[model samples]
Target: LTRYDRMMARRRPKKGQAASKGYREAKKWRAKTYAKIARQRQDTGRKWAKKAVTDHDAIAVEDFRPKFLARSSMARKAADAAIGATKKALVEMGRKHGRDIRLVHPAHTTMDCASCGARTKHALPLSERTYTCTACKVVSPRDKNSARVMLVRAGLNPAGVEGVRPPGALLPEAA
Candidate 1:
C-alpha cells in the first residue's frame, strides 16, 4: 500500500500545461524517495541472505521469479521485498563455499494436503496467515506448509525420510 502510494506520488508523468520547472523539481524529489526505499530493502535482503548462505551448509527456499509477482497488483510490495537481491546474494555466497542452495517449486505447496497428499484449491486471502484445509484437515502456518510442499518436491517426505534430491536442490555442480 505504501509502495503504491509512494510510487504513484513520485512517478506521475507530467501532463501538458501542468508541466513547469517547479513541477519537475517535485517529481525528482518523489523519484529519489522511491529509489531510496528500494535501496534500503535490497540492502537489508543482501545482509540477511549473506548470513543464511554463510551459516548454513544447505538452504531450502521457495523458487519463485520476482518478475511474475511484479505483474500482480502487489507489484510495489513485491519489489520492496527484494527477493532478487536475496537470491543473488545467496547464490554468490553459496558459490564461495562447497554448499548448496535449494529453491523448490512453489506449485500447490500451500494448498496440497501434506498428510494425505491430496491436492485441493486453496484460495486463502493474503490477509489470512493460517491455512485450514477442508479435505484432509491439515492445519499449519501458510508459509510453513508451502515449505513442506517444497521439501516434498525435493523428494523428502513429511516424516523427514530422505530420497532422491530434486533438480536445483543444490547449486549446479562445476562442469
Candidate 2:
C-alpha cells in the first residue's frame, strides 16, 4: 500500500486538475485500501481483546501511548500494530465483562527484576530473550518476567495468579 501510494503520488494531477480521471481513480483506490486495512485491524483487535477478557480474571497491560510511539523511527510498524485500537477494545471488553484491567506504567517493566524489584544495571537488548536477575538470581523468559512485574505493579501476587506456569516447566503435548 505504501509503495502504491508513493507511485501514485508522483503521477498526481497538478493543482486545479483534481477532477482528472487518473487522480480520481488513485484517490478512490487509496481510500479503499485504507478502509480495508482499518477493517482488518479492527477485527483482529476485537477478537484478541474478547479472548483475553473472556479467558482471564484479571489483565495487566502496559500503559502505552500509540501516538507517542508513532512519532518514533518505527512509526510504520507502530501504526501497523494498531496499539490504540487494541487497547480501546481491551478497555471496552473489560468494562463489559466486569473484569479487572490494570494499565501499569511501561517504564522499566521489561528490565526490572520481578523477584528482587531491582532494575538491571546494564541495558537489555531485544536479542536477549532470557532475563536473569543479578540481584536475586531469578531467571526466566524476558516476556514472562515482564508479565510478572506487571502483575506485581498491579498489586497482585504473581504466584497466586492462575495458569501461571513455572519457568522452564515442560508441558504435555495435545494428542
Candidate 3:
C-alpha cells in the first residue's frame, strides 16, 4: 500500500494538467486494493467478535484511542492489525448478545498486578513481557495482567479461568 501510494503520488499530474489514462488506471487499482483489504479486515473482525461474544458473558475492553500508535515506530504494523476495527466489532457483538461490556480506563493497566491488585512504581517497557509485583511477589504475563486489571476496574471478576466470579460476590447497592 505504501509503495502504491508513492507510485500514485508520482503519477499525479502537475498544476493545471489533466490526469493521463495510465495515472487514472493506477488510481483505480489503488482504490480497489485498499477496499479489498478493508473488506478482509471487516470479515475477520466479525468472525472473531462472534466467537468471543459466544464464549464469554462479560467483556472489559481498554478504553483508549489507538490513533496515537500511528506516531510510533510500530505504526504500520499497528494499522495492519486493525485493533480499533476489531474492538468496535467486539463491542457491537457483545451488545447484540445482551452481554455485559465494560470499557475500562487504560492507564496503569500493564503496571498493575492481577493477583495482588498492586501497581508498580514505574511503567514497564514494551520489551518486558512479564509483570512482577514487588508488593505481593505475584508474577504474570504483562498482557494477561493488563486484562485482569481491566476486568477489575470494570467491577467484573478478575479471577477464575472459566470467567466465574467468586462465590457470594455481589454488586454494590445503588445509593
TM per candidate: 0.61, 0.82, 0.80
For residue 15, model 2's alpha carbon misses the true position, in angstroms, by: 4.2
- Per-model C-alpha lDDT, please? 0.66, 0.82, 0.81
- Candidate with maximal lDDT: 2
The residue-by-residue lDDT of candidate 3 on 114-171, one tens digit each, is 8877879998999999988999998888898888888889998765543454344443
lDDT of 2 by residue, 122-168 (tens): 87999999999988898999998999999999988898974764444
Rank by TM-score, descending?
2, 3, 1
lDDT of 2 at 87: 83
Q: Judged by TM-score, which candidate is best?
A: 2
lDDT for 86 (candidate 3): 88
lDDT for each residue of candidate 1 in 1-175, tens digit (9 for 90 to 100):
3554565556556675455565466666667877887788778877887767665566666775665554566665566367766777677677777676677776667677666667766567778787777777878888767666776776655555334344444544642
Give residue 41's error in model 2 in angstroms: 1.0
Flag regions of model 3 displaced more than 4 Å: 68-81, 160-175
